[model samples]
Target: MRHAILITAYTDFFHLIDLTNSFNEDFDIYIHIDKNIYVSPICLKILQSFPRVKSAEQVFHVNWGGRKHVDAILWLCKQALSLSTDAEYFHLISGTDLLVKDLQQFCNFFDKRKGTNFLEYFLLPYQGWESGGLNRLQYKHPLDQLNIKELHDRNVYNRFVNWQITSRRTRPLPNYPIYGGSSWWSLTRDTVNYIYQNYNQNGWYDRLEDTFIPEEMFIQTLLLNSPLKESIVPYNLRYIQWEHKHGSIPAILDEEDIPKILHSCALFARKTDSRISKKLINYFNNNRSSNL
Candidate 1:
């Protein structure tokens, strides 16, 4: 049974190298590099050194209200499926992620669920244009209250227009359902193929991906609505600390967080910066070979 370490990265290519080198487990690495990010010569060299890494050239310029992120991930999923049809599990990891356990143990734990999924689900707000549709139709936005400027540039503008002009215009609108969960997941081949085969037919997926993709919600909703919901493990194995109350993303890991990280009992922890790299290196050097 084969497994893959799939990553969607922007500027932190080196961090991947550091993590990859420490893990001796046999797994293929597939990366989606954002075209907008400027890759340095050193980055290219590091990427080439990893024999298992397949560099995907296709990049998407995702915008705040655009479907580009979803498009990029969908493209990556198809590429991964084509490259190796035998891959049992596709483990999605971020550029900022670090392994907390030995690679063998990680593989062992997942091997038990060879044909299952690790995706979870929760209903959350669907952002961008989709939100606008619910606000207008569901809340009964007055004709003058409709802001065309907000709808015109959003990726779902066309869908919104159709809904607005058609049966939705005069009918009582239903609440817009959304999804949320950990962005990271380990998907079985069966589920992966299902997504590739029915990319567009599903109304909720097509509509959801229009604004948010490769995040907590999109995959959660897709999997929940699929036959593999029974296989989903409710909790993700990553440990993340949303350091501040106001920040959208988590705080970068520093030296001070090492002890806490070592005891987190998670397979991986994310957002480690150069400040914590030495501690990370030392920890891996001391414990990388162990089952811990």
Candidate 2:
């Protein structure tokens, strides 16, 4: 019943520590810290100190809506696959994510469904996205190389997108239908191996490099088109709120959200903060046994 937790983190070292501590010996944690942020040597050493924890030797800048995010994820997957061959499941999650389920509960959930792949997905031309999400792949996205948070850079990015749209410039769509959703997922070892093998052999890496937020689409599109699609459960097992708050897309969870979070069948919840989620984290810590 071994599991691998693959994490991509940028800030908040203390929260990251708590995240790793949540899992027991049955889990191996693989982490990739964003290279753009400065992390103290002691912090890095402390993270690596955990017996089953391994930090990625190679790091990436990990810009938002960038291919580097996807690259970081793939790199983590590669590291986990190479190091933890006996792991039955790999759970891709963020550093801000917290395990809502106890260790036994988490393992039991996955053990009962041995071959299932859990991810949230929707086909292309989804009404929720502008241009039905086609613009993400149909047009060239040079902004991926720049920081979208900077005012000057964001303006340039917006101008490029507008110009492309006005000029009717679009790259030819790939032959396969596109699918996308929340990037976090729990996948079986066989599915992960297939993704790694197929991605390397089919040259999807280069094709996805210039697309916007390819991380959300790459795995979904790849798996949905393959035989493994049948095994996909279509729920990523993470409870997340999409409302914009605290300057992020998914609102950071707080104590106010505790009831819903506890009630949900989700194994984890994301975008928590040490400061904002103090009460929520403490509740879990104090009530660990009762919650289970």
Q: Report the number of the highest-TM-score candidate.
A: 2
Q: Which lDDT tens digits does candidate 1 get at residues 133-225?
A: 333323322222222336654434555556666764544422444456667777888887787787654565445532323355567766766
| TM-score per model over all chains | 0.74, 0.96
Error of 2 at 15 (Å): 0.4
Residues 139-158 of candidate 2: C-alpha lDDT, one tens digit per residue:
87865687887888899888
- Cα deviation of 219 in candidate 1 (Å)? 0.9
Residues forming the 10-long window of minimal summed lDDT in candidate 2: 200-209
Alpha carbon lDDT of each predicted model: 0.63, 0.86
So what's the TM-score on candidate 1?
Answer: 0.74
